[model samples]
Structures are given as structure tokens and as C-alpha cells.
Target: MSGTLHLAQALSNRRRRGRKKDFRDAERLVKRLVSQELTLSFVPDGEHRLWRTLTRTRYQRTRDKVRLQNQLEALLEEAHINLSSLVSDLLGASARRRCMR
Candidate 1:
């Protein structure tokens, strides 16, 4: 029973080490890919051209345009606009006070 338990622990330790090595290798691959950057290329084959045309037509429709516009409007609604009026007022007041001195 003791020997079996020791063997099981050894197996678990080996599995853990193997998983750690695999994770390190994956991290290295990701870092290399990120450093090199990435791009998508569409080769102008017959099938690719057909798919591209279909995609473009789908996106160019009025309904898709309306949907995209609505999405943009909703996103802009959630964004905060920072006005420069207050900042300009403060700077102008400081400059005027400095000039008077």
C-alpha cells in the first residue's frame, strides 16, 4: 500500500511537470506571435473572391447600415465628452491675474 501511494505521487508529480512545460511552450509561442504581429490576407482565388463579394453585399444593405448606425449611436451615448470650457476659463483667469500683477 505504501509503495503504491509513492508510485501514484511520482506519477502526479511527473504529470504536473509535463503540464508546466507545455504551458511554458505555449506562452513562448504566443509571445513570438505577438512580437511579430499578425495580419489577415485574402488571396484572390475564385472561391475567396465569391465569398468576399457576398460578405460585402451583405454588409452594404440598408438594414445592416441601420443596425451599425444604431450600435454606434448607443456606444456614443455611453461615452463621456470632456469639455475644454472650464479648463480654458481657469487658464484664462490665471493668465489675466498674472498679467495684472
Candidate 2:
């Protein structure tokens, strides 16, 4: 027997119930979960969640590194240092060596 189940809200034809929603409505939702009434939907397993977390973190770090490099380049240009003009890479070895001077 499959012990795991994932579900989502099944779109309903019920009339719109607006700002009057309260704790009782939440209780109903819990009851649905208990009774396996929610519509089936994609739910990633533990391994997939871990993989997503790792990849997302790596992607975000890469973006942050690139952003910081761009900011540094802009700040250097604003200070009238045209290191990027002389070097193919602003943060490369040659530029950094020149900067150390």
C-alpha cells in the first residue's frame, strides 16, 4: 500500500465566500486532509527537495557573485580607474596586479 499522498485544492463550483472566512473554514480544510478529500497534485519527494535546495542556493550565490563584481566595476569606473579598458577581465590576475600598484 502506498503510504504517501499529496493533494491540492480541487476547484469548486461553490458560490464565492469572501471576507467572512474564519477559523471554522481552516478546520474544514484540516478535516479534508484527514479524510483524503483534496485533489491529487505534484509533491516532490525528500531527495528532489534536497536537490532543488542545493541547485537554487548555488544559482543564487552565482548571481550574487556576478552582481558584486558588476558593482565593483561600476565603482572603479566612477573613480576614473579604467582597469577594465586595459584588461579583458576587470577582476583578473593582470588587473588585480595593476591595482596592487
Per-candidate local distance difference test? 0.50, 0.79
Question: Which number leads on lDDT?
Answer: 2
Q: Give the clash count for model 2.
A: 0
Candidate 1 lDDT by residue in tens digits, 1-77: 35211111222222323445777755654554456432323347689889999988987886777777566545644
| Stretches > 4 Å off in candidate 1 | 1-42, 62-101
The per-residue C-alpha lDDT of model 2 at residue 4 equals 64
Q: Score every model by TM-score.
A: 0.22, 0.65
Q: Flag regions of model 2 displaced more than 4 Å.
A: 10-39
Weakest lDDT window of 10 consecutive positions for candidate 2:
7-16
Candidate 2, residue 26: lDDT: 66
- Number of clashes in every candidate structure? 0, 0
